[model samples]
Target: MMKFKVLFLLTIIGLVTCSVNAQRGVRIGYIDTEYILQNVPEYKEASSQLDKKVQQWKTEIETKLNAIEQKKKELDNESVLLTKELYDERYEDITFEEAEVLDYQQKRFGPEGDLMIQKRQLIEPIQDQIFAAVQEIAETKSYDFVFDKSADVVMLYSAERYDMSEQVLRTITRTSKRSQAKSKKERQELEDEEVVPVVSADKDERQQALEDRKASREEQLAAKREEREKAAEERKQAQQDLRDAKKKEAEERRQKVIDERNARSGSTSNEAKTVESDSTAKAKSIVKADSVKVQGTVKKDSVNSKMPKTAAEIAAEERAQKLKDREARQKELEARKQKIIDQRKKAREERERQVKKNDSIAKAKKNEDNN
Candidate 1:
């Protein structure tokens, strides 16, 4: 209830704010920050670099922890035979290493840590540029108010046309392209005079080696990421194909079973139809014979002597006809009910077969996996 109340108040406040903005003739627009970030190459590169570093750091941490665990196990196993002095030294060494690992983990992953600082440094410039680009777009478009749809602003509805992210991205992209072109032109002018590439000739060999190692590390990280993604995609496609094959096989088996059942029932239906036809023909023959016998027993002026049918007699014939119609309808209903029942039975059987097939497939897969 408290949450609901808070939400209600917030909604009311938002409505009032929008209403005030509208009364002041303000135009509103929104931008998706996440979308803009996705479009920014520098942001992606930074993120990938961060991810690589994080992975490396995590691996280092795990390796250190595992080493400590192994040493502890060995010390425990040999403790009974070892002298107290030696045992204490080994245990002290393990504790020191464990402390070092914990310190390193905290340095990499704790709040206000090296990784956090590096990440902030990496993204701060990009974020500033994005904000500047957004500002420029807002100014040129004469937008009175712009909101970030990606932010924690509550949005019950948003229209696509009001989005200004594309505008911001376009502005940023143009600036980057111009910067690149200017740099390239400068490099070309230098190259036209046959100037050699700058190789930091004054730098120490150690510094140069460090820079070289950093470049190689980045390249390896990029290559590994690409390979991993490619392998993952291939695995996904293979799994999809396997699933499709299984589904196709299941469907074909079910269809074949239904077809065979229908064929068998078709013969029975044909025989029933033949028997009904014979019964109908026999019934018609008997009626004809009775009519002839009645005609032979009647006088020649029987029609003339007979009175016309009264309303009650006509109504009686109509009632008889209605009863016969109702009986025919009941028979049709029964037939339809029987068909539905048969269909349900067939469906249940098919489901059971499918379940059995799935169980067999699962069992086979488990066996394969175990092997």
Candidate 2:
């Protein structure tokens, strides 16, 4: 039968080729029926259901066969004690069971059996779909002849350009999609939906929509990253400004203390000079007044005049106290600045750590969603 088909195909090809020069050339195409069947969802589902039925039938047959075998074994074991008539009855029953099992197997698996009938029924609709698609394509594309590559007719060489399997599959898919609708209105809606291009496998609307969604998500992620970077930069700038402000305040305080120290030093120098001038004038007075009584009076007056030296000492003590106070204030200011810096540093680190945690969480969620 296969050789006959091949010979017929060759004859047709030769005739078509001979007529091409005298008439319009035949536009020939081929499709793989097997490929079409594999791609059809309804067909695959029906095939699965049919396979399950076949398995169940096989199991039933096996169970009956096992029962028959067990009965035979029992009959053999008990034959020595049984009477001839009883033994004959038992053997006859066993034979009947075996015959019944054979009939069941024939009924289930024979060429004209239920399995074949149901399988044919299941495939008839799919075959109709393929035929309808092929007819439509032939009419639309003005094909003179269309062949099934998966059929018994063997072709040693067929060009890929002449393969219409994908187009047929697409057409069948559209038909199945329409038929699946519960109502005429829904069917119409499905029919009105955009048809995928036959030549372009990547032109599926759902896949395109998925790619669009992916692109949108990536853009959103990029925007979020930009926002994070901007916020981090702003935070860093704020920290720097805070540090500058603290430094300026501390510098101002230090300069003020230095000015106060210089003022005190100048005043102390003036007081010392005044004390020295008074002592010199008093010495001159002591030399001028030479009597014992006058000399004693001068000594007492000079002692009274020496009070400025004590005042200068007091001024020196006050300057020392002020210097100590200034040093304490400076130390306190430095500590406060350092504390603020530390606090800000910790805050920035905490924020960055939290951002990282959030990023990790978001990434995990995204991965989960993808899975």
Worst 10 residues of 2 by lDDT: 194-203
With candidate 2 superimposed using the best TM-score fit, by how many Å does residue 79's alpha carbon deviate from the native? 1.6
Which number leads on TM-score? 2
Provide the overall lDDT of each model, using Cα atoms, as 2-decimal numbers: 0.75, 0.77
Candidate 2 yields a Cα-based lDDT of 0.77
**Per-residue alpha-carbon lDDT of model 1 for 1-371, expressed as tens digits?**
99999999999999999997665455578888889988899889989988999999999999999999999999999999999999999999999999999999998899988899998898788778788877776666556788888789998999786787887787676666656765777656544533223332234345768988999999999999999999999999998798777767866886787677677667766765675667557656655664454454343235434767667556655655565565566567657756765775687578668866976886587557635
Worst 10 residues of 1 by lDDT: 193-202
Local accuracy of candidate 2 as per-residue lDDT tens digits, 1-371: 99999999999999988886346445789999999999898889989999999999999999989998998999899999999999999899899989988988989899998999998999898899899999988877667799999999899999897899998998888877776779988887777753443332233435768988999999999999999999999999998797677657755765675577557656755665575567546544543443343455446557667665566555655655565565566556556655765675576567657756765686577557535
Per-residue lDDT of 150 in model 1: 78
lDDT of 1 at 317: 53
